[model samples]
Target chain A: MANVLIYANQQGGNLSSNAREALAFGSSLARSANGETAAVLIGPGAGTAAKEAIAFGAEKAYTIDSPLLAQYQVELYLDAISEAFEKSQSTILVLPFDRKGKDLIGRLATRSSASALTEVIDFKVEEGTVHYVRPIYGDKAYGEYTINRKKAVIGIRPKSHEPASRDENRTGDIIPLKIDLSEEVIVSTLAEKIESALSGVRLEDARIIVSGGRGLGGPEGFDELEALANVLGGAVGASRAACDAGWVPTSFQVGQTGAVVAPDLYIAVGISGASQHLSGITNAKTVVAINHDSEAPIFKRANLGVVADYMSVIPALTKALKKRMGVNTG
Target chain B: MHIVVCLKQVLDPELPPRYFKIDPETNRPDDGVADMVMDSYAENALETAIQLRDKIGGATVTALCLGDEDSEDVLRRALSFTADRAVRVWEDEWENLDGQAVGHILARTIQSFGGADLVLTGYQASDIEEGLVGPVLAEELGIPCVTLASELAVEGSILKATCEAENGYQVIDVPSPAVFTIVSSEKNVPRLPKVKDIRLSRSKPIEELEADDLEIDAERCQPAVALRKVYVPDREVACEFLVGEDGPELASGLAGKLMELKVL
Candidate 1:
């Protein structure tokens, strides 16, 4: 039987949603293979995370805890995960396709001589073989891949799968593994982590995103978008034009050359819908475009199209949202 | 200081969706469109190396690529941006190699070129978006690897970089002889080559390295994964346009729709 291993990623001492999704997917794979599903939690408080993983579908959880892992150093975490992976003896390994996971998946696959796939949107096991599906050409098409190797490492795209619900009544075995880690491998050390000034939700994780484009005129225009985003209890994004115009940081850019987001609701304000920009948000459930130009390309893709001056439209919309949500502006 | 930047030429990602077509037989995009350019993130990586070379005098930036003769266009473009050297590694059998095989080839190519103090690559290719080569190459070379680096600076043998994280940015310091996968940043915009420099780059010699020259293990260069099929995704949901007399009415109607959808 082919054992499946899922890396349970945690942040701020809590299990990440992506980790839960991986566990769910791993469990499905295990069921199909008639094997076992194991989870590996690496960091300071792995024991607590392991229990959480068990509730979320893991049959066994491996905890690799060490003081050196208090902060995320790539080398240390890589070594710990690698050792845990070996102990699990799994044929298939799953991880979140985020920043941290992306950094490690390729290296781990190379070291283990395993086939690897990233940003996997879906997967299926057919006749005891695993097939992975991923986006290509900036979401213009989809490619289905099959690994020929004995082992495979797959990185699941974040928010692509719904997380499995936690069951407190469920219980599983917790295994603690010990491996000798050398400090010499620690070539890179994180100097500091600067928090973003915008304090609601992360752009990638936000259920709703209010984005502004060049029609906002300048940097000051983002403030209005911010107000709308804040009122909606969501995140703010910007078009490439806005970022290039110095209206917002590149981090806020949502397009082909920027972050790909699939929020539940995406509100694009004063933005002409460019093909480059549309690639990032096509997966969004509902798109609302607010621009004065009636012939804007965004209207073709948006679920809601409003033709008006954003200067008057945005502030009024913000006020209406505040009223509907019953939030005090004061 | 010796720095190596890996480049890949891909179909223009900004092309309209209507123009994109995948060949079912080949499991690849149709090369009908002549809009091929260097991957955006790779351009950032190249710019990062150039900036570092400018900051620390005497640093040599070598641009390396693995593809057919068409890939030389990007290498020449790299040279036009003042890269000290351009090398292309190619073979007829290498056309369908997966990311792991390509990574091994790159590592071998770097080794043949006397190795480098630092290696840089894009976070991912715009076409494949696999994001495997850099980290796999780093492992093949037995070096530390960092991904999603937006800003990078080298001080002596120490490398300091600012990387984008989920919540914010994290400044990282690593030793020399490391690999970095650069993410696009506004500050690291690629410099366009002047017409004179573009003409001059044609005269510069580009070294061609073949698979036989590297003497790589044939087994190691075999693709680990096989592409089963490629197809355009079907758009299942038709866009529904909301109608309203004005801005406030439109906002209210959209909000109501969200509530109905139970996403609010």
Candidate 2:
């Protein structure tokens, strides 16, 4: 039986959206396998978050609430998660492939001796075994894999699955797991969690993005991109090259190793599309490229391509956009 | 401080997309199309290790890998640029091992080395991109793991790493004998090997190891995850080029099309 346990993490007294997505996903997968979906919500707001998990379709919610479990110290979190896994007797575990998931999953799977699957975008269940599909070669190809072991731990790629819709009337069991944390030893206290710490529209939340690249040559071009982004009410993003050259903060980088964004409109300015950058925009609804190189690989993925110098093109585009949108500039 | 950096030779990720192909029988990237190169992330890990070693004063960086003879080239590359020693662990019959199995072999190999102060690896390999090795290795060794570090520091046996988060980064501190999976940053971009160093690396002996040498569980090394199939995902978008008399005209035309499509 595919009893799936999802770590429905909460932030600011509510179940985070990604965790909801995971719970929704686990519920669907469990139903397919004729099993149940349970969520382990840890720390301060976990009791409240448990209801949210049920709203998102979890059949059972395992709450591990402790003031000591407040912050996400990996060792403490891992211990609690392990306790929930055992008590719930789940065969499969699912977590969102976010920053904390990357930190905790390997250890969790290792402790349980479960097969670890990373960044899976698709999955299939046949004869009670799960098969996973993940992007490889920077999303140039897809590879499908199945776990031979009965126990499996999966890290679901963020934004790959839609957020689970909520139903307030949906009810389920809430099991509060009693766990001992008095003996857990951790050498490190993670240097505090600073929420987002970004000004204006956060890149992850941004619907429209104006991203620059090495082709900008220097930091000044980002100023123009910033101006355009400002008028369009979007976030500014950079490629690894631009960020590497010290033109922008590494946080602004949009690539495989950087922030993965799924914006509604992505404008690539002066960027020669590399797969690392291409992978980040896989979910973008519309891609527009403005580059001098006509043969830049980005053109293949761009919905609209313009071969030109971004310096002249960006200013014109901004002005044209203002005129087209009927926005008055005094 | 003694740091061991795990390296893997993979299909050159920078190869043109059109040249990419998978051999149906083997379900592996066609070796004919792409030459194997040191994984980009491994190079960053090596660079990060070397930098940390330099900071720690009189430290050694050992290069480790689990691959065939062709894998030695990457070890040599590591030797050329700051790695003090090189080791290769492989079995003749071992082919297409999953990340968990590879992690087992690596953990056993490290155990044979009597352990070290730190272990470093790339966040993930470019080919399979599993990213399970570093954390799994840490688990097998019963040590802590801090992953995706953009910057690392060694201060009196405690290792401090600045790791990437969603919108910001975190500074995590772990004690000695821990695992670190490095992510590339401007601060850790790999440095090139000098010609003299490259020539000297060719003469340096690469210590070869087998499953028996480390007493690894050969049967247990079997893949936890098995590859079912390999296929290319079609993501082609027909692009419409905007031509104009000048830059302004092109911009205006592009803007008009976007509006028509209701993209903005």
Candidate 3:
């Protein structure tokens, strides 16, 4: 049986959601292949994290507790994880697909000379050979890839799979490893500066999104959408056209070249739904469109459509929502 | 400082895929193989890094890849374009691996190179468009990561980058020895590889590394996602016809039809 090692990144002594996803994925693969899954946590006060990882499905948990591991330092992490992987003789490596995961995978692949793959959406293991499926061509095509190595590392995209359930009764051993990292290779961290944090949740993670387009007029119009979004407990999104017009940030754009969102509720306000834009939000559970033009493409995709100017309807909706929710703007 | 930009050759997008192909008996244009070219976004990212190195001095740009030896042609082209050096971690088997696994091995190789102050990568590989490598590599390295970077400036030890965020441009100040994933921007447009530079690049170098040489878990790199099948989308648009008295009437009717379809 192959030994699988999953890096369980401890975020404030808890397992990151992405890490759980990796654990669930690795565990399922291990169970099917009769392999063993080991979770490795590297950071200060990661002992709890190591144990929690096991509770979530790992057979064993590895912990590397050091001052250098406290903050994310690229070189130090590479050194530590590489050392851990080397010592464990792990055959399969797993990590959450995120910033830290991305950095480690490429550099680790280079240093370790292992085969690697990224952003795979599905997988199957047959006779010990693993084949992966990923979308290509703007998700218009799906490609299958088979890896020909006994050992390899993969980063799992977040929210792609359900996380393994945590069993409180389950427990595992924490094996601490020694890896030395000096400050010479370290550079800096987020602690060095204070960022101007946003007041609301990030658009990528929000459950609901109310987006606007060119018809919204200007940045000032976003205030109404923002108000409506706040009333609906959702985030705000924008079409590429609106973003290009400098009325909104490109990050809020939902389209072929922008972020893909699959929210529970997606509201298109005055936006002519273009194919490129629809591709990003097609996965939303429920789409509602409000536009003056009855022929707007967005209305076709929307489950519910109100053929009216969004400016007139949004304020009323917000007021109704606030009144119903007993929320006082004052 | 030495930097490396890994590029992939991909199908061109300007000429969209032709979905329906008439049988040879009918002589209809088949979905011609999408013409292949260097990924535009990656090339732009490479240009940005190269320009940064040129402006700051004391930086070298190396192009790396883990693709078929034929792809060596692509790397050579990248060298001819802007990279100072080229290295192909040639492996015929890698053609099937996912981007995440590829990134894992690349990280290892980069780690072996040692002491790279900054690692620059494209926001996403055009072929897979996973947009995960730069972030995942950053996590693996435990370093600060700035992705979707539109503008970047390196001042002493700090890497100040302007990234496209949800609200407005976010100016991120990260300490050097960092990694950034570059997106396409006007500033990143690549100039043609000078004819003399192309000649010089041939003499530069192309080193090869075997996947087995890195010595990490051979199986850990297995893919998470598996593609079960690939079939072309059915060409099934029901064209709605609208008849009217005149141009405006016809336009309004078409608009009404669009409204009926809910696509304006």
DockQ of 2: 0.71
User: DockQ, per-model, please?
Assistant: 0.65, 0.71, 0.15
Candidate 2 clashes between residue pairs 3 or more apart in a chain or in different chains = none
DockQ-sorted candidate list, best first? 2, 1, 3
Residue runs of model 1 more than 4 Å from their true location after superposition: A11-13, A214-217, A255-262, A270-283, A292-301, A307-309, A323-330, B243-264
Off by over 4 Å in 3: A126-128, A187-197, A213-218, A239-245, A250-262, A269-283, A289-330, B1-9, B12-40, B43-121, B130-148, B156-159, B162-180, B184-264
TM-scores, all candidates, are: 0.93, 0.96, 0.68
User: Lowest-lDDT window of 10 residues in candidate 1 chain A?
Assistant: A321-330
RMSD of each: 2.6, 1.8, 8.2
Question: A57 in model 3: Cα distance from truth in Å?
Answer: 1.7
Cα misplacement distance, residue A138 of candidate 3 (Å): 1.9
Write down the lDDT that model 3 would get: 0.69
Docking class of 1: medium
Put down candidate 2 lDDT per residue, B1-264, tens digits, no spaces. 789999999999988788888888988878896889999888989999988888777899999999999899899999999589999998878887888888888999999999989999999888888788998898889898998888888878788888887667888888998999998788988998899999999899999999889968866598888998888878889998999888999988987887776546
Q: Which residue pairs collide, candidate 1? A: none
Report the C-alpha lDDT of model 3 over A147-250, residue by residue, as the tens digit.
55556677675556777899988877789887777778654443333232445877667787889998888889899988877866778888877876777656
Question: Which model scores highest in lDDT?
Answer: 2
lDDT of 2: 0.86
lDDT of each: 0.85, 0.86, 0.69
